[model samples]
Target: MAYQQPALPYADNALEPHISAKTIGFHYGKHHAAYVNNYNNLVAGTPFDSMSIEEVICATAGDAQKIGVFNNGAQAWNHSFYWNCLSANGGGKPSGELAAKIDGDFGSFDKFVEELKAAAATQFGSGWAWLVLDNGTLKVVKTGNAQTPLTSGQTPLLCVDVWEHAYYLDYQNRRPDYVAATIENLLNWTFAEENYQSAK
Candidate 1:
């Protein structure tokens, strides 16, 4: 069966100003859709065609012959998670367990933001910055190209896509500005908490 593009949980304009409707339109409708289509084409009639997205990801991971499949499947999953990680009313500060975890791991919430911002800003070329749970500890990590935390033995709790396509529609060359705004105004703490709890 062909993979389907997952619909956004909210309207394209829902995360506006910080992340515009225009941005989501292209990012989700074009970029993400392309990956899903490409993945379907890549897997058609193959033995791996019947595998779930996660199964394909793990099975074909690191296999040179399957690089195309890995890229498409990982990007499809990453983009879906990335879109859900944003909301118009999101960002400010996390509370409860998420807050305490940030404080415990990074000293303070502000410091955690600073580190996350830096990671997003400094990810050379197209990639993503993630707040991941590795062995029950939270950490900030960056993955280049279609790489994801799943391939690294880390469970992703939250993520911000630093790919040019993710921010160019809004911030253009100022990728750092987009990252900062996302951290301040678009991060979905509830989604992060849910992912954290599930990973544990």
Candidate 2:
């Protein structure tokens, strides 16, 4: 089946102040949609034509010759996941098992935020910072453009896209400001919890 662009979990204007509708419009409607469209084209006449996005990502991972396939497919998957990672009335902190896991793994939610902030801020260029389940252990990891945890053994719980396109229209060159706002106001901990339960 040809991959399609997934809709944003919330309305485009849902996350205001923290993430404006204009940002979402160009980011999701344009940037993410482009990846979805490109992925479909790249896989149209190849083995990936019938494979799931995850399968294409895994199959092309680390194969330099298939970098285009990897880039488009992984970016499609990543943006889908990224959209679910945000919410209008989300963030603050989690409760239940997810809370315990965060505290246990990172000492405190503050520390986890600190770590995630550092990851996104220090990523150097376009990339992502993630909180993932690695060997049943909660961990934070970051990857460069089009790289995703799906190709790695870890299971991603939450992610923040630090690509300039993700925040340039809103926060401009201050990537840290965008990262901080997304973490504090847009993070969907409930979605993270759901991903965690499935990971285990």
Looking at model 1, the pairs that clash are none
All models: lDDT? 0.91, 0.92
Residue 122, model 1: lDDT of 95
Q: What is the lDDT of residue 1 in candidate 2?
A: 84
Worst 10 residues of 2 by lDDT: 4-13
Give a tens-digit lDDT track for model 2, residues 1-200.
88978777888889998888999999999999898898898889887898888888999999999999899889989999999999998889999999998899999999999999999999978999999999989999999999998888889999999999999999989999999999999999999999999988
Compare the candidates by lDDT and give the number of the best one: 2
Deviation (Å) of 135 in candidate 1: 0.3
Segments of candidate 1 deviating more than 4 angstroms: none
At residue 96, candidate 2 shows an lDDT of 96
Q: Quick one: RMSD of model 2?
A: 0.7
TM-score of each: 0.97, 0.98
RMSD of each: 1.0, 0.7
